[model samples]
Target: MALHLPQAASLPFGSLTKMLPLNKTSSSVSAISKSFNATTSLKIQCKAPSVIVSDQSQQVSRRSGDFKPDVWHYDYIKSLDNNYKEHAYEEESRMLRAEVRVFLSDTVNPLQQLELIDTLQRLGLAYHFKSEINKMLENIYSVDKFKNKQNLHATALEFRLSRQHGYDIPTDVFDSFINDEGDFQTSLSQDIKGMLSLYEASFLLMEDETILEKATDFTSKSLRDFMSRNPGHELTSQVKHAMEVPLHWRLPRWEARWFISEYERMPNMNSNLLQLAKLDYNMLQAMYQEEVKSNIRWWERTGLEEKINFYRCRVVDNYLWGLGMKEEPHVEKLRRVIGNLCAIITLTDDMYDVHGTLDELELFTEAILSGKISVRHLGLRPDGTMVEKRQA
Candidate 1:
């Protein structure tokens, strides 16, 4: 993220007789000429310099995927309406979530409270009730739930969520699971719920957490074994999924998008909560797609698709990456800027890798740094030779 702006006397790419300074030493006229000759010599080493550049423009960037274009139509995406803006929908969702929130407040059983809290989080409704959730966790910690555990699932859930929210719950809280033989209690593996909780909990491990590291290994193996024994069981799909990507590591929007369907299938799932999640997810997707369309418009206006063919023209992927970084709907314009920046950076990487020769790269680097060459100043001749433009 270092931005260097150099001092300059000229604004076009050519054989520089002198270059003024911002960072580098102010070299004399002869020295500048020598540097220019050296750059020419570098390009001369390549066979058919412009031919190489042209050939490279035809080559695919290493990072470019061969995937086909996305099938999502803009009109179809824009047509999606989750009714989240309507008064009735909002109040209904709020009331349903309120039931869960009230349940969180009224419960005396720590296990019951933590289970509901965990469920609220996985359902993507926790963002609406951070204060209640924090208070609940603080109450759990105040009771010293970390030190003693009557239930394995409850204990592991507490430890995982505590650490996740930066509670500094030591990894040794799990030491009880290990036996005198320096291994997990073999009997513990049989409790499918406990094993699954520990399996998800293990993903919260930070660096040098030996106990959690071992816990991860233990839980993973146990869950796989449990899956083998309980084929086509109710928990089979969930157990398999947990092993693939623990909840902690999953991307938030993607998790919500996925959990909406999974939560709908749950036997005792709150219907209002499911509707809210679906509305929220669809609304966000529509916002993101709108931003994406703006990015496509920006890209097309630049005519980069026709002009720059060396890199991946993944406009949607660019927007998604920005969304992954910061997906809040209020920042649609910011996401658009980030999307364009991402796309240009990807294109630049491809240009540097194959098309931009050393001389061209150095010249552009120095020129760009020095606020020169605002225009396309370097062009390739038919025979693959560099021609520097002299601006009028």
Candidate 2:
């Protein structure tokens, strides 16, 4: 390789060879040392090339996250109160669920069955009826009842629900919706119910499904226009909600919370199902409330805030996890155990990754292995008794 350099530039070796070839000290290397120091001190300071900045680039970065820290002066969570205990609604909940199942069993039309399944899923009560729902869906798909309906709303509904439940339906079923102009039929825009159903259905598309890609673009525009024209209509809010976040992507608990309110407003809403849902939610929420208290207390007494820096308190993290493990009466006990485990593990991980020294780690390991670490303190104590403490 050929060396390239600016012709006027000087290299450090330019002087180094000159000095090295002609150096001798008169006073026992002192003169040579001084000369060497002086030569090296002649620094060739490198200047970084300046970058040009536009006026817009330096003002501020856009906000990346909306998370805010807890701001209360006292222990707001622990100091606050809840009055709920376990409910005696197990028997009642069972009865209501049985009645709803009876209602489902009596319904036979495929389209009607799909509507019930769809509504139950959206309402988040579908978890209770999984076996029955699957049996109905299986029969409907095996008989090819999906194609028996020509109505766009019913076809889209069947297509979406079937695909969602893991049945394979042809993407070509949607070709009927495209007009001679090679776009989604503009006349079909008036079918807002079908449009919304199609919009939800479009999300189930596979990679090569260009028809669904067009359907997504078409339905989005159509729905946005519908929202503007009929802002006061009953379906407007639903359209807006579905456009923002699809049903499959929503957290089941939050979806249930949102849907329960919507379900209550329906004139034909089943009283037993509605009552069961509300009671179930309230009782489950109370369990979460209890778990949150346990976690916050564990976090505080561990002195995690003083010991750790910048790590989140993680009370919310623990509670959300515990809420996901819905095991009823034993769930409270499980939550406390698991919440403590998570808090310890999280802080311990941060310590090992970021703040711990080799010496501190050695001590931590020894303490744990030797049983000197108590449930309350898990602290590294060398000269103290290795007491096998029971859990706090």
Candidate 3:
């Protein structure tokens, strides 16, 4: 729960250079040179000096990532079925969306409106009501009026949502909660909901925002103390989750998956919102399954997974990464493109890290830099040998 900002680690470049296989006389270099020499028609020129292989015992040893086999197989992925994709469900979803829109527009209380907006966002339904949410946030920001200045939850929620949507809310808004000692009042610690709100909002702090810096320390400590003291409290679970990873940093799809279950347990949860979240999530999950299946087919067609045995077969994981980047259902094509690229990149990275010797890697890098290695010509054998793939 300690709030530590990320810092880049300095690599030991000097020591790394000493360990590189730059020696031209190394047996690995000779092995690679011999491998390249065997494929004369392939047109790959090795950077290492060629050595005549009098003995056939010499072979380049490849490293393995030791990664476990993927548990999600093609048949399992294809079997994933959800009724939410049907037209009947679509009509129901549309009607529920309309009802939610009315509810958003009709909410008169500013705090209630902010809470609703926050709920919509966490539930991953924000995209469906983007315009309405934008308009509501604009009115809220422009008015610059809150009935209760001392209300920490309202203030923090407003600050977070507004700043998140590009509004420059000043950090001084929390000054009222500070005492003569220039610290958040001790009494505020008793309000678990407010502490949680402020904890999340503090992440929106810009460079040199000392007030928020103080707020982060105060709220984190207060929330942690509350969790230790009241472990069985209803809000303890939430505080623990937020402390582990703040809402701002959580993955949207994963967050929605978690919040949907949590939202169901709420006493005052809206039935329409809960139903829409579940249906929408299922529909999107169905789409994701199909997209991953398509990408896996594409990967199989490329033959990289078969041609290169040293790498990980992670088509589903790559698709999940792509989904994380663009979760909107309408961006299926973009997601597929991202998934394909991620797959290629992952394979290439593993090749460089686990299989390729320094000489081979350097030659490959040079070929790439000189625009000599095209996708059509690039091929590798199981024995870490490069070969040319002729067009059929």
- Per residue, candidate 2 scores C-alpha lDDT tens digits across 153-229 of 87888888889888889877766777777678888788898899889888888889988888889999999999999
What tens digits encode model 1's per-residue C-alpha lDDT throughout 74-117?
Answer: 33333334233345535555665676666666777777778777
What ranking emerges by lDDT with the best candidate at the front? 3, 2, 1
Worst 10 residues of 1 by lDDT: 14-23
Alpha-carbon deviation at 206 in model 2, angstroms: 2.5
> Mind giving the per-residue lDDT tens digits that candidate 3 earns over 1-392?
01111211211111101111112432222211111111123222112213322223547665566665554455445544534456765776788899999888789788899999999998889999999999889988989765349899999999999999999889888988989988899999999999999999999999999889899999999999999999999888789889988988777876776677778778889987887886677567657767777776676667665555666676666766667678998888778777777766777897698768798899999998797875434233322123444589
Give me the overall lDDT of model 2.
Answer: 0.62
The TM-score ranking, best first, is: 3, 1, 2
For model 1, the superposed segments whose C-alpha errors exceed 4 Å read 1-100, 330-334, 373-392
TM-score of each: 0.72, 0.65, 0.79
Best by TM-score: 3
